[model samples]
Target: MDLDNIKDIWSQENPDTTPEISLENQKELHLPLEKLRKNMRKEFWSTIVLFVFIILFLTFVDFHFFKFKIYVITLVASMMLITAFYYYKFFLLYKNLTSVDFNLLENLKDLKFQFKLNEQYYLGYYIAFVPFTVAEVILIFEFIPGWKNLTGFSFILYLSIFCLLMLGALYVVGKWWFQKFYGKYFSQILNLIDDLK
Candidate 1:
């Protein structure tokens, strides 16, 4: 066959797969996407408010040790910074969902990818606090006179156990939290994509 014939055959076989979304499908998608965006916004604002409350509480609460206060404030500040970073990425996804110009199939695929990526970020956000939790535990042991009785091998063993338990709990909780807040919407999107296929 001539090159022109081959080209025509190829074009026919692989017609544009990413078509514009129909008004009906877009309307169907509107609810789930809006729910996801709404939940994200609520979570973001709640986090900000919770952080503010924590800072204020720490500032006003009496602490016998100045070092403990400083350490906790610094830790909270660092956590806020990390949370802000993740939220920025989430905001980008939110913006994409809001855009009117996206191609249907391609955009759905991209959004699905973004959702999976963000789910990892969500888990990482929790896991990232492991070190901070350990530090806080150390601080508690140091500042609280009652906890000082643990020493040498006993202290190390207890700390190790506590950290392990905390790590597992954080992972489990992170998964549950993500599923509770966002998983349904993600599943809905996946179903929509399947329908398109």
Candidate 2:
């Protein structure tokens, strides 16, 4: 940006000053923030694509890709897919979540607090799913012919219980996270948006 253009923007603070601000200077000021927003959107979509592909494969293709049986392949594929997606998505969400240029410091500080709280909740999600994931993978071994007698009903029971446990964990985590982070700041952001309107 040209010095005179920078001077123009800086001069806005002081009515007594007369300075020219370059268009380049204005563009430069906004460039980083725009880049950050675009990068965040890109990261989000990457994870979304990963998840959609996993769902597509599981829903359509049979999983016998190698020496692994279909059941084992499905179990491993699903678990790995979910784990990677969650890890990647949460990492990006925490890393990219940000705000700035608000009119009030209190509002900005609240938004900062929300970012921290959300990171914590993502960590919670990572922890809660571990047990469920283990159980989900075990169902594959039970599909072996003779193994059905030993693992059949028990396997189904484990799957059912694990699913319920996962949901309960998610609910608890969500509630706690909402109260800890999102509940307070969400309303504030909404109010700010409304006021701007």
**Model number with the top lDDT:** 1
RMSD of each: 2.5, 13.3
C-alpha displacement of 155 in model 2, angstroms? Answer: 14
lDDT of 1 at 130: 85
How do the residues 36-128 of candidate 1 rate in per-residue lDDT, one tens digit apiece? 989998998998899889989997899888988899889988988888898898888888878834356777778778888988888788878
- Top candidate when judged by TM-score against the true structure: 1
Whole-model Cα lDDT per candidate?
0.83, 0.55
Q: How would you encode candidate 2's per-residue C-alpha lDDT over 1-197 as one tens digit per residue?
A: 99999999987788654343345543443444354445445756776787688667666776444434455455656666655666575555445444344444344455456556655755665565665555554554445455446556876786667567766776687678555543454454445434433
Backbone collisions counted per model: 0, 2
Model 2 misplacement above 4 A? 1-39, 63-100, 144-197
Q: Judge candidate 1 against the unseen true structure and give its global Cα lDDT, from 0 to 1.
A: 0.83
